[model samples]
Target: MKKVLMAIVVISILITAPLIYNRAKIEWNNDTYEMIVPYEEIRELAIRGLDTDTIVKTLYDNGVRGISFEPTGIQDLVKQGLVMTLTKSDLFSMLQKEDENTRESILYSRENGLYVLLRNDLDDRWENAIVKSFGDRIDKVTDLPIFKGESIYFIKGISKEELTRGMGAVANPILTRPIGFDENLMTEFASYGFEPVFRIGNNINENNEYVLDQMKQLQDKLGGHKIIFTGNTMLGVAPHKDLKTEDAEQYALRLVNEGFVLMPIEFTKQDGLNIYAKQFNNKIVRLHSLDFFDGRGGYTDRATRAVKERNIRGLYVHVADIKKLEEETITAEQSFEVATQELEAITSQMADKHQPGIAQSYDLLQASKWMTIAGLVGVAAFIGLAALMVSEKIALLTFAGMLLVAAGYIVTGATMFLQAASLVVSIVAATWAAISGEYINSKKDMVFKFLKGAFLALIGVWFVMSLLYGNQFLVKIEEFRGVKLLFILPIVLTFLHVIRDHVKDLAMTVVRNYYLVIVAVIAAGLMILVVRSGNDAGEMVSGTELVLRQKLEDFLFVRPRTKEFLIGYPLLVLGMYIIYQGKGWEQRIGKYLLAGGAIGFLSTVNTFTHLHIPIYLSLLRTVYGFVFGALLGLVLIFLYRLAKKYWPMIQERL
Candidate 1:
């Protein structure tokens, strides 16, 4: 049975090795990234007296490669004097004395509502867009006399207050409905050698065909293919009908077929974005954008780290200090200077690894269905082998049950089931490795024990990578669930395994004051570990630690996690040395240390779970951690030996 399991494992590895290599090749080739600035922000700078041409030229020279353009809406049209709105009272007052019949007809049609009037110079497309965006809420009223030679369009279900407030509101669902793209703005930026990055806004009552048609037309006009959706949903999302799932899939299919690459923003919640991007088949780039107000000061450092560390290819640079500009604290030129300096700082540091250009989607090689089945079999066999160390009966039962589950997953292809199974595999493998260490009689024995644990953990890592590898995971549209659990489970399991035969002794030790204090300290450390285990760790990490991390990344190219190298692995090695000493206190303390050492195995597995990171970088980081941790363990062993040699004499002299 063991031989059969071993053969299954070997075959699975052979099948998955090629898939891993292909993923690595795709990631390595996706090195180019774009430094994009919003066109509205640039237009704001131009409004403040800076020349538009000069600002574009300066930004381009400093590695800004793309200009993001959001579709124009009624609010923008009002601001540009292309459209006007008035209350019924205001409209009646504007009517000439000779236009009594028109006024009487308007009063008969509607008693109260805001009326929208387009400029006479504008074309019919503008009216068509307003009708399409607002639908039945907007009514064309030729019965009323033309105002300033433009036709009257009466708006329903909107009060004057709502219209005024909604117009100035950011990302308002109704007021920010797409009217059309500003073709002249797109042409201006494209003339200055900037790739256009389009932002799509959701309209709850949107005409799906019109929205899709507009997107296709804009793509044709600008000759740029990248798109990012704005607001809380995608272009066709309808919350009233609850059509997000259906809308997302349909829009995704249309967008992909249209040859438009989706760019999902990092750290932002957009409903249906995950479903939408999944349809692109690895033809998407992850984007990182900073808030215009919140990111004013440290934009450069944050953006630099994003591109260098996170595989973020689209750097959405929001350099304008909108708050200061609104407060009149700085001149527009000063803001422009700050923007240029920020861009230069970020681009200069990243020039060696990345070039400024439009980021292209990765054409990743697809793993075959047979390879996935083989991987699942390998994971089951490996888990069974680990169980064999504890009990043959348990091993056989676990293998059969796991095979049954894998078969069900293959038939159904349920993502939740796959994620749960992968988490269980990770916990079991890490816990098994953590308990595999025995009495370490010599330095070579200690080293071998540590290496063996790491190897076991790595096998778990491989199993997980094969199971969850896909474009969705690669761009973080889907992530490994239960990360905090993955960090905590092995520690708990290892502790239970170590204390299984010592419950009475543990209860006695628990009552001791020093032991209670030590337990409290360990609990505190575990709490910190749980808090710092996710993508949002930056919020909890300290400034001093962040600076240290930056220095390490600079020096090592890929920084090893501090917990793995500095604390977990070294403590594990020291624990084994204590177990070898064969003293009463050593036996009692060594068990606790061994349980703590399980953290190293869990951490090793967690490193590979960050699917967005390149595989080669994770491997480099693990190797660095191993080497550094072994050296630290040797130092701890030397200190133990020196204390043992001199402690008795020193105690007698005292």
Candidate 2:
């Protein structure tokens, strides 16, 4: 039975080798990223008497690769004094010596309705967009022959208070409705060799057909479909109902088919983004931005780390505060100089690994059904082998049950089941390795035991990685669940296993020792471990520790986890030495120490569960952890020997 299980593991590994290779190739090819700044920021500089062409050229020379452009709206036109809005009463008061026909036509419209007057300088696209957006609620007042050459329309079912004072009125209502992309502005940027990142707005009330048509026209004009959607929802998505399930799927399909890649901002909430990205086959880049007005420092370091460590491809930079520039407290030249220096610092830090260019979606490998099934079978085999360490009966029962579960999951194709099974396999593997080292007598024996445990834990890593393989996992649309459990469960299981044969003796020993003190210390340690498990655990990290982490990252390129190399691995070795070689009180405490060593195995497996990190980087981090941990463990053993040799003389003097 054991031979059969081993064979299944080997075959599964062979079957999934292609997936590993494809993932590596995709990550290797995606080595370029883009630095994008809002077009409005550049326009603000232009408004301050800085030449637009010179600003663009200067930014381009300093690692700026793209300019993000949001479409102009009626509110913007009003603010710029290119369009005028008036109530019917206001318009009636403005007109003097009008023809009777024009007067009669004006009287026919709603008395309280709002009228919009478009100047000749405005683009005709605005008129078309307004018509499409409002449909029957808006009417062209062409009956007035006296105002024939002027563009004027009356909007119905809207009050002045609703237009001016309603919540989000300026951003989401009819007045602030986006017309379309500014083609001339886009053309200017393209002429200066900037990739235009279209920032899609969701303020307009339009049907799906018109929304898709507008997107198609923009794509035709810009020649690319790199979209960064603004607001809480996506284009064509309704505000009240959100996007209907079918509509979202249809829109996602159309966009993907048209080669539109969405760049969702990291750490921000956007409705339906995950579903849309999943439908796009997860072929999207992640964008990172820090608010320049927040007054926090270290923007360059964070941006560089985003590119180097988190697979972030788009760095959305906020170069200058628009309000600050408008207030004249800061000059355009000063803002430009500051932005240039920051860009240079970021680019210089990342020059060794990435180059500034247009960010593209990764062409990742799609997992085949057979490969997924094989991965599950391998995980079941690993679980069975770990169970075999206890007894043949338990091993056989576990193998059969896990195989049946894998078969059922294959039939049902449930993702949650796969994640749960992977988590169980990881816990089992870590626990089994933690207790595998027994009768350790020499340094050679200790090293061999550690390597054996590491090898078994690595097998668990492979199984977890293969079972959860997909583009969704790669981009973090789907994550490996139960991370806190992954950190805690293995240690708990190891504790139970180490004490199973001596529970009565352990109870007595604990009562005789400083029972409350030990419990308090263990509880505190567990709390810290739990607090420091996830991606958002940066808040819990101390400033000194963060500096140390940065220094390690700079020196190693891929920093080894502190838990694995510094604390967990060394304690594991010390525990093994004391339990096997020491006499008296050391033997009693050694069991707990050995159980605590499970953290090392747990951390080794945990490293691979971060699916968004590149496989090569994870592998490098694991190697560094093991080498440094082993050396640290040996140093700990030397300290133990030195203390043992001098303890008797010191105690006699006392």
Candidate 3:
């Protein structure tokens, strides 16, 4: 019975597990609504360069049919007549001319069964108190309303066709107006069959006015319509009163189910623009305004000359329009297009300023591939030859072989591409050293002990460098030269001392000082020269007017220095350490000399530039190297003792 119950429980969990695991299933609106509204015409109203996808998405989210289009190329479309203009009859003029109770009218006109949108605002009393401020351009004055008494005047003329054309315009200036207003005005607009699209408060502090106004009016409109409310800034006058924090979703939900066409506008932001079209189950149509300059100069030239090209549908002014713009007060439409072109030019320039880091890395990899291949072949040949020599000398030679393998790692900057080769070299070298050291002891065969020592040394190199440079050295070749190579040198030197068995021999004294001085001088000189040259080359190549030489210098010498120090320092330390610890007491003679060389190299880096890393990482690298070196020493001693113990078994295997 218990078994049966357990099986049942398991089956139940299996059946429900997927449902619980896959939470938050995306809800989609499969209802396909025919886009009956002429969105292309509406898109032509805004600036041409506006992304049509943006506008279309915005409209569709608000349950606005085909009337939604990005304002990208609407301005240019207006000039081109691809988007229709509003006739006087096309005006949906809402006029409230009464004194106490307002009078209102919404004059809806259509051209061949197509809707046009044009909206104009007039106060209850036309304020001529001061000259109207319409920047710069002014021509003819046809109808001017004369203010009378204390009563407010009201006339909103909307050209449906012109608005549709404006919507389709490629580029245009932003159109802004006040938000939710008093109930009386709302009623007036509603009475005329015109939905209160947007309203403004009497003052900035009118909280919940937008929501309040909608709630009051929504009684008359719901169940099958859409309403869009757009907030321009953090300070909005609507349901924002209820929502203490800024969230677009809360505001959207307030109006989506209501039977009003929703449309909102907002500025570009980093998180990304809020698009509402998908909520209403509609796909957005992006429209872009093609600039005449960009179209004629950029696209045309690239298309003709380049191996790869793309077609563009953008806003471009005609040569005739360009001439017309200079002499006369061009149409507001024309002004909108000029503004769009300037914006596009600025956007394109900003985008071109940055190149991705991934691309730069790929370029470096392309250069490193051949270098890695050569290193692998060289290391492999050396290892195969050393293994075949099999004798007492071969065991001793293992220490020297390991050092050579470690040296290669330093030279190559410990690159990811070279890692495979480096690993193979390290393993082979370590094995030889372990087996050889054991044979030399002849009494205690401690091969395992020596193998541990070798392994530790290899690990020490990697850990020490990581502490010094972090993972940056792995990815950034510059860090390898600047920081890693410094560590690699010491490892190489220690290895050399170990192979020669200098502790019991007199030959060590002479060999020690000579190699130390040479290494120190080379390291110091390389560091100083490379840094100084790097600075000079950077200045000469980067800031110069001469392009060809500058480009050549950058590709050849300048860029490589970026990686040199990062790769170099670690290799130097590894090389020096391997040499120092490998031969025991006799190798101590060279320690001071190697130290001086490291100091010299460090001095060069310090004097030239403030490129030294943080103090903490440097200290960490130092501690790691010292600890690792000590561990390796202990292991090497153990292996020597162990090999002597197991001499007979080791000799038979050898």
Residue-pair clashes per candidate, as listed? 0, 0, 153
Can you rank all candidates by lDDT, best first? 2, 1, 3
True lDDT of residue 611, candidate 3 = 15
lDDT by residue (445-465, candidate 1, tens digit) is 777888889888888888888
Model 3, 54-142: lDDT tens digits are 44343333322222111112223334443333333432233234332221122322112222222123232212210121112211222
- Off-target runs (Cα >4 Å) in candidate 2 are 87-113, 142-149, 157-172, 204-211, 236-243, 327-329, 510-513, 649-654
Off by over 4 Å in 1: 93-112, 131-150, 157-159, 162-175, 204-211, 240-245, 292-297, 322-324, 501-510, 537-539, 582-584, 649-654
Q: In order, what is each prediction's RMSD in angstroms? A: 3.0, 3.0, 22.5
Task: Give all TM-scores, in the order shown.
Answer: 0.91, 0.92, 0.22
Clashes of 2: 0
Query: Which residue pairs collide in model 1, if any?
Result: none
What's the TM for model 3?
0.22
Model 2, span 1-654: residue lDDT tens: 788889999998889888888887888789999999998888788888888878888789878888998767666778778888877556666565787656656666464557888898877777787677777778887755546799898877565655566465343355655666677778878878888887866553443146556666767776657888887777555456643656667777888887788998888888778668867988899999965555887787788788877778999998788888888888988887788788888888883778998898888758888898898888888888888878988988888888887887788987887788788888887887788764577768888888888888888888888888877887777888888998899889888877787788766763645777878999999889888887556547788988899898888887898888997888888888887787656765666776777888888888888888888888899888888887888799899899999999999999
Q: Which candidate has the top score in TM-score?
A: 2
Answer with 1 or 2, whichever has the higher TM-score. Answer: 2
- Model 1's number of clashes is 0
Report lDDT (Cα) of residue 351, candidate 3. 20
